[model samples]
Target: MKYRSRTDIFASILQSANSNKGVGITTIMYKSFLSHYQLKKYLSIMLENDLIKLEEDEHLYRITEKGLRFLQLFSNINELIDTTKEYNV
Candidate 1:
């Protein structure tokens, strides 16, 4: 398997959370293919940046509007990169 960049990991986590109503940390880690330590580090950064919010009462995490925007932007960027590669540009 290839190594995933931090941005890729972040996008994966966001996508996972966005798909589920209230995703737990363990679920995100598994879906994102990240180790527990890596997940914790990324989760901390994401929470601090307001990309994801924690539902303390439910003990679950949910993606915020900012995270959705990031995901959309990331997808667009990836598409652009792929197109560039196809054209060898």
Candidate 2:
């Protein structure tokens, strides 16, 4: 895998959350190709920033409206950058 910027990582994580009704940590980890520690670190930042929310009852993470916007902007930027849009690459 090529080096991924934090923005790329954030976008990857958010994409995982958005595609599912609700996603668990393991699912996010696999989808985002993150380690447990990295997942914890990024998820904490995302939760604190209100980009994602945890449903305690379900033990699942869901994307916030802000996260959707972020993904939109990320897509726009990727279009301009002409980077690969392939997931799980």
Candidate 3:
């Protein structure tokens, strides 16, 4: 399998969490194909950066508006890169 960059991983995590109403840490890890340690580290950073919010009552995580915006921007950037590569620019 091709290696994924941190931005790609973050985008995957955010996309997974956004799709689910109340997503658990393990669920995100499994869906994102990340190990426990890696999930924990990324989750912490996402929470701290306001990309994802944790629900204390249910212990579930949800993506925020900012996170959605980040995903959109990331997708656009990736598309731009691909387009450039296609033209050998």
Candidate 4:
């Protein structure tokens, strides 16, 4: 995937995680087109910032409320751009 797709991948993953459903890092890595090292680095930062939580039992991850709020803000920004594009203004 192109590098820009990384943003969309993150938004999708965070939306999924917002459901409080756990997700696997492998899946995220694959979908985001990120290498293990890159994913690990970003994951570490997100974890440290309390944006995501890990489930020890299943080795899964979920987004925290802060993450969800951030994702929502991103979505709103995307919507604005999409709407502007439609207007061709």
Candidate 5:
């Protein structure tokens, strides 16, 4: 796999969380291709930034509305960039 930028890793974690109702740390780690240590670091930032929430009752993580918006905006930007790349040829 290509080296993923921090933004790419963040997006991947969010996508994995959004893919399910509520997922555990291990689930996100595997889906995001992150190691436990890396995931812990990212999850800490995500929680602090309100991008994701940990549900203690279920021992799971869920994406927040802010995170969803972030994903949508990121997707829009990527689409625009890809469009430009296509035209650059």
Candidate 6:
């Protein structure tokens, strides 16, 4: 597994948090395969950046508008890459 920094962590968090169903740390941790130490550090940074908001219950996280916008762009790039790869193969 690759070691990810705060920026990398935020990208995943932003993406996962976009859904209205909300997301949990465990899911993010699993999806990103982040270590406990890295998860805490980056989660705090994501909150500071306003990319995600913690639920009052402290069990769920939601994406902010800023995060959604970033995710939308990221998703577009990912789709484009997939399309290109498909054509190449």
TM-scores across all candidates? Answer: 0.88, 0.90, 0.86, 0.72, 0.88, 0.70
Candidate 4: stretches off by over 4 Å: 5-13, 16-19, 83-89
lDDT of 4 by residue, 1-89 (tens): 33455556567556655645688888777765677787887788778878788998989988998888879888898877864344544
lDDT, candidate 6, 7-87, per-residue tens: 556777676677787888888888777777877788887789888889977689888988888777777876776543435
- By TM-score, the candidates rank as 2, 5, 1, 3, 4, 6
Better of 2 and 6 by lDDT: 2
TM-score (C-alpha) between model 1 and the true structure:
0.88
**How does each model score on lDDT?**
0.90, 0.93, 0.89, 0.74, 0.91, 0.76
Q: Sort all candidates by lDDT, best to worst.
A: 2, 5, 1, 3, 6, 4
Question: Of models 1 and 2, which has the larger lDDT?
Answer: 2
Query: Relative to the unseen true structure, what is the Cα RMSD of model 1?
Result: 2.6
Clashing pairs for model 4 are none
Cα displacement (Å) at residue 68, model 6: 0.8
> What is candidate 2's TM-score against the reference?
0.90
Separate clash counts for every candidate: 0, 0, 0, 0, 0, 0
Per the 3 Å backbone cut-off, how many clashing residue pairs does candidate 1 have? Answer: 0
Candidate 1 regions with alpha-carbon error over 4 angstroms:
83-89
Can you give the lDDT of residue 71 in candidate 4? 92
Query: Which residue pairs show backbone clashes in model 2?
Result: none
Off by over 4 Å in 2: 84-89
